[model samples]
Target chain A: MTTASENFDTVGLKQSIEGTFRFRKWRSIAVPFAILGYLIYVFFAFDVAGLASRARPENAAVLLGDFWSYKTHITRDNRSGDVVASVEGERKGTYPAGEGPEWVAMGETTAISLYGDASVQYLPENTAVINVPDFGEITTQVNARAVVLRLPDGKDIPEWMSVSRNRVSIDQGNWRFSMTPARTEVFRYQAGWELFFFTLDSPFYGKSVGELIALAIWEPRVTAEHSNIVAMIDGFWNNKMWRHGDVFWAMGETVLMAFIGTMGAGMIAFPLAFFAASNFAPAVWLRLTCRRLFDFLRGVDGLIWTVILSRAFGPGPMTGSLAILLTDTGTFGKTFSEALENIDNKQVEGIQSTGANMIQRMRFGVIPQVLPLILSQLLYYFESNTRSATVIGALVGGGIGLLLTQAIITQKDWEEVCYYMILVVLTVMIMDTISGWIRKKFIKG
Target chain B: MTAHTVSGTAEYLALVRRRRLYGAILVALFFVLFASGFTVAEDRNAGGFLDGLHRIFDFPKEIFAEAFTNWQNLPRLFVAAIPSLIETLNIAAIATLFGGLLGMALAFLSTRGLALWPRLTPVFRRIMDTMRAVPEIVIALVLIFLLGVGPVPAMIAIAFHTAGALGKLFSEAAENVDLKPVEGLASVGGNWFQRIWFGVMPQVAPNWSSYALLRFEINIRASAILGFVGAGGLGYDLKTALQWGQGKYDQVVAIFAILFLTIMIVDHLSDRARQRLVKGGALV
Candidate 1:
């Protein structure tokens, strides 16, 4: 019923449709299979299976525990027969002789009341006794040669206790007791960071909130030379355990590095961007050269720049800022030039028709269109650079990153690491909010 | 009418003058701040800015001189760096893959209309925010303590941060997607997962892929930096060579060249690919 040409067209259309369907069917199966195969390869490549054995779950437990709690060490030296109670075993947090937490009754016999009915007592002659609620009392003695432990009647050494030739340690849920040849010690685990506000040397060490407020407002000065509030701030700032003042300064330096780096890069890039822009540059070679320069700067990477700059500037905020500046200059140059290239040419033509000079044309036409984009970009970079400065500060040996790395390197200062992490997070979030606000208020508005 | 026109012109002139004056004052204030901040930074630095400016090229020149003399070693050193470079790339690629998957779940959970449980949206958002706020270096360093030095720590750290970063961008894109298809899917008795997978995902996939690509670029840099801090990669090799000082300058040059080339190539390719995706060209 159809002509020959019509029949040919019908046949071609049928074949094309069938081919497309077949291709789609193959693609759908092939893509997923390919991805699955790649993932299988990556699994072996990254050694995901070996990770379980290499991972230290105990270290994770220790880190998590250290983040939220402090331990008080109650020790009696067998040779000197002197008892000392110190927080986290730090000398700065040590309670003075004969002065300890109310939970500990320090006298001829020192009793540490732990959670529940469990308690540890330092008896005379380098001996210690622990009473668990369900179990009978267990005694440990530190002699000249070794530590000897006596278990409760018919009670084998439980899984919580570890015994050796010269040492015996019993780890209860909230309290731990250990006896060695040299000393008998009990570590009472307490929630919250101790000595965070005021050190033991301060007169306001253990004051309640209400009492501190009263002291600050109506009460007589705590220190004769200054008011209660001033003295309180002084003690808090100079607290050897916390070092709040140094931390504050380090945070400021970090912010300063970000600000200087971001704004400086913007200033440097703005002028150079014109030469890189294809629409603005008078000479092709100049445009090409500037573009290459930007690429080279960016390609060098910030890490390399930091290493090189630190070598010159000798590791400080300046080196960090400069490193940020150099890397961002390349970034801003590329982005700004792209922004410039995308501008409406009609506006420039309009200004030119008004007999304006080049500078005037740029100011009246070009800047108006691009200023918002440029500013939003700059503000965004500023916010991110605040975080980068922290990492960069670590490399350059400046800012809060230095303190954080130092704390982390100590392996035992996990609480301080926790504090620094919180501060860094807070600072970054604050910057993000501020920059978002500025972008909304100035650029979008 | 003439008097009204004169007053209007006068008012317009006054407004212009005021705006110009404000701009000038802002510029002045910025310059002042810049100058003062520079002075403070210079004071804190071990070497003054002016003193260090001239000597900046000395180290570079020394390295170049050493490297130039050992030009025969360049190719061998370049070959030596290939494995570390691959490791670095693998870190970035795996992080992007894992982070992109996590970010998708987070975005779906947090975005309105697309959310499975809208009440928990803010909770998921806050979690992402916290994750993003913690820098990769902090996590990497901490994990290094537990896992020891390897690409895995850096990989996990970058992945965590990338998830948070990409989730935010993905959610923003998802928020702007048309809800008609989702409603249509739901009307057919499709479940929550089916509705999102069939309806919202197709619309936002391009934008999400573009973001992931950008994040991939950033993660590359992050992985390298983390490597510099003891994670094993090209950066670790570079550090070791640089520590050896003069004899290993050739290795340093080779590493630098490899890194520079890799970054440039990736940047170029990604830029082109993003343009194609955003411009609605056929994806490769």
Candidate 2:
């Protein structure tokens, strides 16, 4: 009986060992495959580039057109009496007044009308043409703004000429060109073209037609007059389109939506994160449930949420905002939970020894420690959402993105697109700066 | 000491009062803002709660379900994705390899507060800040105008941005290393070059590699989105497919699947490599 039992026991031991090894091997292979499958599912499920491309052909063509537009030049002393100044007509007003003012060298002058009040510095090499159409009163305000005109002397002539904000009609006969230290009055015409100037603009203002033409032909890069501020705003307003009115309205709504959405998601996520943390919740089932919930939420991208929201809500800011809330909630929950899990557990143990209840222990022990990290992360996400708002806005229709998309498709106006893009960029930069400041002030080491 | 006691109670009380006031103000501000949102124009349905839920759920469902079903057209989607993917990878690869070299050089140059000119450190720091402050996508958009649309512009754009990002990451990693070896190398009359090679790099290599790998992963994901504005990538294909709708859905899905799988595999491999390196060091 002893011999038989010993053989049976050996067999059992061998079988168990073999089974364990096989399981381990399979896991090593299976885990990676599972992960790969999950990733693929997430990616395939969330990919929305196809939607963008339908609008892209025209968008791409517009971009290419913007890049490859005509380079204009005029004869210095031709019969047309010195082609005195040029403007690139856009949705906004003229750039580079007729005579130059004394400022840093803003290379190449491209005359493009900006959507809002803008002060761009032009490079000496190029000329920009700003086309302001007949909007009457609005044109006067723009023309009243100071512009520097370049004269033949390679000197800046500062002047404030009254051209129409939309379009100023000019008569070749009654136009008088004069300059002052503060402002230069150029001829006003009723034929839809007027020139203006400021003294503090650039020295390239009043150069001779030949010199101006040479500059335009040889060196053609116009730097923004306010490079620092312009750089910040260039992303939103510059070379971007507002597809429909929806993108425009949506852009504005996105900011509020992102903030509210983040807050809503964050509130829901915080306690859940604590529960999900391994140190705080030792129970396997609780940990698994929390983790799975987080994965499900975060696994999907915001864009996917947007389409879903659009369908349910019939396309609007509410749809966009709600979509943002759901996705951001999942993401914040996952990140916050990870932070909680990584915290030193000894502090919790210390509080426990003092006979504190769960709430008191969490308040005294966990909150103090995790608050800074959490706040900083939240601020960072807020900054990120400002940009995301623009993108998501494009889908559901409403915001600056809508304006941007429309500009691209309808007008194919690269310059106007550029203007809108700059606005978005500036907004994001401002948000980032604000967030950084708050984080510095409030977050502890 | 018993005869002279220093009481900090008053000071502590004043500090507590100040903090409490600030906290109350913050709480009040939050309520005020939330209240304003409540006054916002309501939807026609008036049942704000259910509408919000439906809107939230359906957006993702419609977008994803459509994208998923459309993923059936594998070949066309692959063609679209492949070029963009290659372009994106090329951008990342070139940026990483070159940026890595440039970052290492900058790390050495600015190691001891501007090696070439101590006065220029602040200037370099400002320049780095400005460069990094503008996101890579923004940079590409600007460059697209100046450089014209093509791979070269995209490459340059990525190169410039990554230089700043990787440089910052590398500098921090280098700065945090143990200085004992550095001092030892210096004591032995080793030159600066030798000190960096023998003293600093050895210790920071693992961290540097880890950071670089992490950056590579991020760059891959970022590059996917660069195509939205003509920078060129799989993102472009994805965008096009989405906009065109219906016929191209399968293609879009296929591209996403490919990219998703690629990312997973790459992430796994990188983690394994990182683990091995970390373990090998611990063993050593």
lDDT per residue for candidate 1 within B176-230, as digits (tens), equals 9999999999999999988988999889988999999999998888888989989
The residue pairs that clash in candidate 1, if any, are: none
Candidate 1 residue-wise lDDT, A1-445, digit = tens: 4698899998999999999889889997998898789778778877878888888989998899999998999888878888999988889999999989889999999888988978988889888888988888999987778888898899999999999989999898678888888888889888999999999889998899999999999998778999999999999999999999999989888889999999999999999999999999989999999999999999899999988888888989999999999999999999999999999999999999999999999999999999999999998898889889999999898899899899889888899999988998999888888888888887892
The residue-by-residue lDDT of candidate 2 on B105-195, one tens digit each, is 6665655532445566556655554444444554565555554455545556666766766776787777677888978988999887787
The per-residue C-alpha lDDT of model 2 at residue B284 equals 16
TM-score of each: 0.96, 0.58
Model 1 stretches astray by more than 4 angstroms: A1-20
The 0-to-1 C-alpha lDDT of every candidate, in the order given, reads: 0.91, 0.56
The DockQ values of the predictions, listed in order, are: 0.74, 0.10
User: Candidate 2's residue-wise lDDT over A1-445, tens digit each?
Assistant: 9999999999999999999899879986997797567545433432423334333354465355453342111111212122223232222223343432122122243222222322222222222222222221111112223333323333232233333223222222223323222222233222211122211133343455676556556644345464422332332233222222333444456576667677767778898887788877769799889877775665444544554455566665556566667877777887788788777778888999999998888888888888888888777777666666655655566555555565655544555566566566666667877887877786853
Give the docking tier of candidate 1: medium
Top model number, DockQ: 1
Cα lDDT for residue A251, model 1? 89
